[model samples]
Target: MKITQTRDIRAANRWEIMHQVLEHSPISRVEICRRTGLNKATVSTIVKEWIDKGLLAETELGKSGGGRKPILLQPLHQAGAAVALEIDISQVQAILTDLSGERVLAREQFPTLGESFPQVYHKVCQALDKLLAEMPPSPYGLVGIGVAVHGVVDLSGMIRFIPRLGWRNIDLRSLLEERYHVPVSLDNDGNLAALAQQNLEQASLGPEGQGSEALPQSLAVVNVGDSISTGLITNGEVFRGFHGFANAIGHHTINLDEPVQCSCGKYGCWEQYCSNGAVIAYANTVLPQPISTLEELITLIRHQDPLARQVMDRFLTYLAVGLTNIIFIFDCQAIAISSELLSALPYYLPEVMRKMVLPITHVEKVVLSRLGKSGAILGAASQAVFQFFQDTAHAMEPGQ
Candidate 1:
């Protein structure tokens, strides 16, 4: 066995070195040693192994003070690939990405509404097969696949519930793994989106000398689409409590006294009030005429229609209540709101903040998701990328 693969601690250190390269590539061996707190000799030895494994490649030489210039190392972008699928109520989105998280192949999106779980699963598998067939031959082939489910996915990969689509207790991970013979990861959409956001933020931090600042250690991503869900990220890791059900903030009670029914059969659930569906439901009651979409409602608000304004105010109030609850519970550095509605009504962020009981400084921390519709799918893809890194840690293990 190679020296770097012998000890578990050394394997972990090697993984960290590769991780730094993946995040901030075209980096020098000296800088990698500095960032990872490893000796120069150890870094050199591990880099040799990775280069031989074709997982990493040395770039052009860097300037030197007196001796030979240092060789910059980066992830071998074409060595392997990852596939990510995001299953939503109406459609599924898929992408094939490289080790550096760059989309190597064209993405695919198809309808899923009114389709059975088996049908949706078949489409997902087909999508993966098609992408794989398109990829140019590489040493590592396909590393793994990650799926972002728009519902509660248990730790065992069983999808417990997705009320909007009427899905319940589906073992999606096993179904795919059994057929494809590839590693599979299943997670809730909110959590995966949050993970994607976290990775994007981290990747934005440029090379060692660049002045890019790091993201906050703790944050929450609240997605208010047809449904509502929150993903809590703490210290760069997702906090999936008890059966991977953490941050199901949608079902939390917000109006116990005058409870409104939710599709989940819950009373006064936050989702029933703050989701886009909830906003439409509330709008229908107050508007002179019923409107089904957020764009129409926003257009009415822009025209200064008093009734539309009233519904907007109520929606903001309920949303603010939910935001406050999230802040109090997580005490995170920031809360990122993801919704087509937020994009429609970006100007009302201040109004929503004003409704919050917290100080203006704290309330100002709420921000809209920068990722938009791509967050969940990209996040799902990131999971496969993460697994690749873990496997890379032990790439030199006997018969690995």
Candidate 2:
């Protein structure tokens, strides 16, 4: 038991050291020790082991502190790579990124409209094959694959349902692991987007001494596209709830009098009123030419068309209502919205804020997502990279 405990402690130390290096590369071992609260001896030993293992590389000298310049350490980011995929109703997009989440190859995508599950699976496999073929030489090769699905994904990586695609009970993780021979992570697209946004905000905080304000401990990411979904971060971690179905905020009933039924067979779901499809559907009713895409409605609004503006105002109002409800339930310090329509017309953000009236909830805390459409894709890659490090740390156990 003592031996096992010692090994676990060592493995945790190694993870801590590696995490510091990965997040703030070109850092000195002394700084790592300070940041991780590990002794100089332990930090030095682990750093030496990783350097010898080709996981870390000593780079040029850092600034001197009234002494010899300290050698900086950086992760060999290309030592491994991860594949991230976003499977949406209309499209499937994939990207291969290094351990640091830097894109190693151009993005690949294929439309999935009306495609069967088997067909989509085959195309996803083909996309992965193409990416692997183009991957640069690496020590660890492909470390893992992360998938973002537009549906309810349980903690065990089982996709429970995807209303848009009519998919149910798919074990995507096992299938990918069987074929790729690597760790596989499957999660809801909204949850992954929230993870990505959180990482971005944390990264922006910079090194320890930059004096940037700390990120909000609680945050929410709302992804409004074909449908509306929400990712919640509570106390600085993704809140998956009991069944990992916490992201189904879109299905929440917002209007009791709504005559039109939502895809989930509900009346006046939050998504039915706030999603991009909802905006387009409403626009087609009043516009003479019947816009099929959100872009068309946005263009009409940009041109100051009265009908388009009316539709947009209604959309924003409904959006605010849902957001107000979210704030009431979660009390998040901030809310980030991921929507192409919102990102394109940022001026409307204030209008959304204006419509939301709650004394306890500060509407000003609501903001547009900086990651935008790439949130889920990058988040998926980030998840894989994180899992890679965790697995690597666990491999430090004795006899394995």
Off by over 4 Å in 2: 1-4, 209-211
Residue 214 lDDT in candidate 2:
67
lDDT minimum window of 10 residues, candidate 1: 205-214
lDDT of 1: 0.81
Candidate 2 per-residue C-alpha lDDT over 197-226 given as tens digits, one digit per residue, 9 for 90 to 100: 887776676566343556877899999987
Tell me, by lDDT, which candidate is best: 2
Question: lDDT tens string, model 1, 1-400?
Answer: 3454346766787788988887777889988988889999999988898888888888899878689898888888788888888888778888888765557576788999888888887888788788888877888878888998888888787899997788999988888778777788889989988988887777676565344455768889888887788899999889889778886788889988755567777788888887877888889988879998889998998899999998888888999999887887778788888878677779988888888887643632778888987788788777878777777777675566
Candidate 1 local Cα displacement, residue 4, angstroms: 15
Best-fitting candidate, scored by TM-score? 2
The residue pairs that clash in candidate 1, if any, are: none
Candidate 1 residue-wise lDDT at 10: 68
| Candidate 2 C-alpha RMSD relative to the actual structure | 2.0
